[model samples]
Target: MIPHLWNDLEGTFFPESALDYMPEDRLREVQLQRLKAVTALAYDRVPLFRERMTAKGAKPADVRRLEDVRRLPFMVKNDLRDTYPYGLFAVPMSEVVRLHASSGTTGKPIVVGYTAQDMDVWKQAIMRSLYSAGFRRADVVQNMYGYGLFTGGLGLHGGLEGIGATVIPISGGNSERQIMVMKDFGVTAVCSTPSYFIHLIEVAQKMGLDFKRDLKVRRGVFGAEPWTDHMRQYIEAASGIKAYDIYGLSEIIGPGVGNECEYQDGPHIFEDHFLVEIVDPATLEPVPDGQEGELVITTLSKQAMPVIRYRTRDITAIDIRPCRCGRTIRRIRRISRRSDDMFIIRGVNVFPTQIETALLKTEASLPHYQIVLTRKSGLDQMEVRVEVTGDMLRDSVGEMEQLQKRFARSIEQITGLHTTVTLVQPGSIPRSAGKAKRLLDTRNEA
Candidate 1:
């Protein structure tokens, strides 16, 4: 039996050498070919996609080059909502062997399906990402991502198992037990949201457990929310683990679109399976390489649900230069924010990440924070909720008030938007074992 690691070129034969090290010209040619194929598949198999392509007067033949993808209409979350349960599925429901869904906090959950072939591709992608993050078949990985409905849990679990890693599918929550199991099992790697990992550090410390002595963890895979580089540095220092970012969305596949290698640079995308494009969110035109824009993806190999020109709304840029690790596949900068996660406050568009960046720079501020958007009269108001350390809370009330003013000023200077800053005692903010809820918009409410 062949091992599934990417670097084990002698053992793994699934992902051909071409996907990673193919010349740029040939890579483009492969993308062009797959783009046409997926476009045709979506047009033929899914009615929602067919109507969308028809409305744009775009046929599969129109997508002959990498640049021609602009002709296809964009797929958004609402389109899946309109389709309901399995409306956008390319294959019949019977053919779909697996199903996954989004949180649906705003409305009906956006669901996705996978056939046997799709499952194989999904599994391979995850395994490749895990290898990219420096995990080996010998490593014991504690999968702390949520299990059901959410894709992070099962997505990481199957991939870890495929690579022959000792996977502890602990499945999110249970901070104390998480530390205990990680210690007793001698976990060497962990996969979870970056915030949850920080919470673990706090709980472990409160319980008088030290990662440097009590735990064997040395690496982590963090995703499901946009975190800043400061948070990465803090996680690395607190837990003594080399943290890596993994990117994916439920609309396309899940948790396997791209990942950071040992280099800790931008994530190398699995372009052979996913055709990626960066486009202006406002104009919907392709953005030049190295320019920040919204990410758009088309799944070339998926059978049950092939999405063409799906607008991901993620904010990042693509780097086409060959990686130092020798992979020629293009990579995307870590996602800083998403369109759904953005909100307008008094004419200023604010992202939670921007607030996070400001908070990280402010002294006496903990990593825990949230953004709230409320409608005051006819205007939108912004509020930043942050937690401070116990020592900061113990300071004089006047000093604490001064800290709030200074923090608000820093945010304004960074984001060019004034905000109401609210400080809480240590551990006051509710923590999450899954994706952190960073923003709450109530602009439409009375």
Candidate 2:
């Protein structure tokens, strides 16, 4: 693989090539320099950072080494909310070229801006992600990730284009048209949420389209949702392609934050663009490398909306080493689950992704389901409402009951918690345009 000019510059700055080969002191020295630069920039440019640092009695000059970064106040999502809109943008509006906002399901959307250079950095980071996933110049990428405000579609689209691939910007939804384009364009690669990909597989089968013979896709870059190894195997088996995991969030820079290589071991992070740190979610103290914690990011190269020590709320670990693919950048494992997404159900920590993984393993005739948590009689009751398609029904009440029992067992096996399973008719659950809402908590009494 040919390294981009930016990658070459990154090597000079950090000697990432030596991460696995160099001494610990050397790596610390490089990180200390970068940390100081970021701290100084945040102190001088961003008002929120300046105020927080001042209140914490932190000065840019104080951050003389990597350890000093711990003295700086950590930034969180709420800080962006406190500032609102573009108050957190470091550079003036004149340099801002593009803006992307959060889906805002919780409250007011946190906005992120990009300058021309920032966009270039984003493109490079995403390109590295795609390259790691075995994308080449000859590959025809069909990006099914949503476009517009959501960064997945456009981010991957730009990176694929940057790599000189034929990018079919096929946003998301329109299952019929998506398959049609895949066949007509001879698309070799696909990018989308793992659930949406599974839904498309079923659609193709129902439409009498042969995934192996008709569709030319050989690889899938699945992201925008938490998935599992079992789900990955199922996707690969159903689609006759290798399914690689990609990771990103709009707050830190969209879908190309990190990506799994062809080896399918772990997603390598572009450390040159964004500095990653894993910290205890509650204590905010750095965890030892190779341990799971909340991922915190610092935008080292961004201009318009440079964020320092921004807490991502994502739970994952990092390996500060080069991969067999020859990329010297650090690699981050696929996110286990977001800290906020973890819910305590009767003293058991349950993740919705775990339930989704269990459901996918079963021969359940449904691609859609919702995990609803409600308080009843002073205790939390969990219900999984799944949509049953025609394939699973097949005029057999015996089979339906067996399947429901199997699903309940599967959930128990994965989560160690009992959940009521409700198999509804097809098309019962509503479809969403962005970030599908699969989990609902109605515990608070009105």
Candidate 3:
């Protein structure tokens, strides 16, 4: 296994990692200063921001303290849709150097731009993320994140190079090639979604390769979707590597918003560059620390597109307590649910992660599963189709029936809703190299 860059005794990753361990008072002061400047930039340059602020009778000058962030109007996904291509950008096209976008449910994609200075800050954030995850210059990292319009690939790619780590820019897919290259190059680290890594583990197993014995990879930085501790435990047990959760969105600044240190308790938000607030998704009121709510963010250093009070809709809580890693930045609970992904069935609210948590409890089932929703008798019905191990598949009918009943019981215990559990073969579920589509709502489909 490759050694991590972190120094346990010194409580620092390296000499340049001072910003992460700065005093809370000092970090807050820097955040406030940057917040004021970013708000002012948006108010002056973006008409949408100006009109929204004016309607609320608030200006950048009104931002006297950090709490004044509430005075600023909230921005949502529609704000980006209404603006289209560049409506929310704070800088001119001449100054903007790059553009990245995520596919929207409707017409136009949610696009975000980055100026040269913005790119530098983004890279610095990614570098911090890598260092915090114990990545070092000596480690060979195979970046499996998709490149191009998506921000995951290039974001980590640039940071890996910036940190002097040798990178194989293998942008997603080609599972056999990915594993072959990993083994040949003696890759020590990987960056990708947890789902993809799990798929890789399965693929390696099928190819007669043991991750713990045949592979040299020791660390994995996974993000771009909400994963659970159960999934983490599965990955660690299956493949001998410490999996770290990373948080970010293209609207704010790609995958550098925050990341977990060696502690892996939760990911620490880069407070100096991005301001985080957990608010009640319904009322839009700020919630106290340790309480779960929607995660909202304000980009303080982004020059191209500085979003103000942008609601991320991710459900998580903040931990303001100091960490053993000595970083002053606060950490957020691992995101397992999204405000928009919840569906109520039989008067019970259900998130796919709840089902995932339940499905992972049994060793007989693989992590691959799908939730199928349909309307029958004007009522919603959920059927979870999960892939079971080959041994379970080859078991006697009586034994298989018992396993199915056990799975249904575990799921009901967690969700309080009974679901039809159908155990399929291992490779029955479609695998995705990017974000896994776990939900299928055919109720609305004709």
Q: Give model 2's clash tally.
A: 1
- Lowest summed lDDT across 10 adjacent residues in model 3 is found at 1-10
Clashing pairs in 3: none
Winning candidate number (lDDT): 3
lDDT of 2 by residue, 330-407 (tens): 788777578788888899988877887788778633368889899988989999998887667767789889989989
lDDT of 3 at 323: 80
* Cα-based lDDT at residue 325, candidate 3: 78
Instruction: List the global CA lDDT of all models.
Output: 0.84, 0.79, 0.88
* TM-score of each model, in listed order: 0.92, 0.90, 0.96
lDDT of 1 by residue, 170-204 (tens): 99898999999999999999999888888888889
Please, what's the RMSD in Å of model 2? 4.2
Ranking by TM-score: 3, 1, 2
Error of 3 at 359 (Å): 0.8
Q: How many collisions between residues are there in candidate 3?
A: 0
Candidate 1 vs candidate 3: the TM-score winner is 3
Per-prediction count of colliding residue pairs?
0, 1, 0
Candidates 1 and 2, the one with greater lDDT:
1
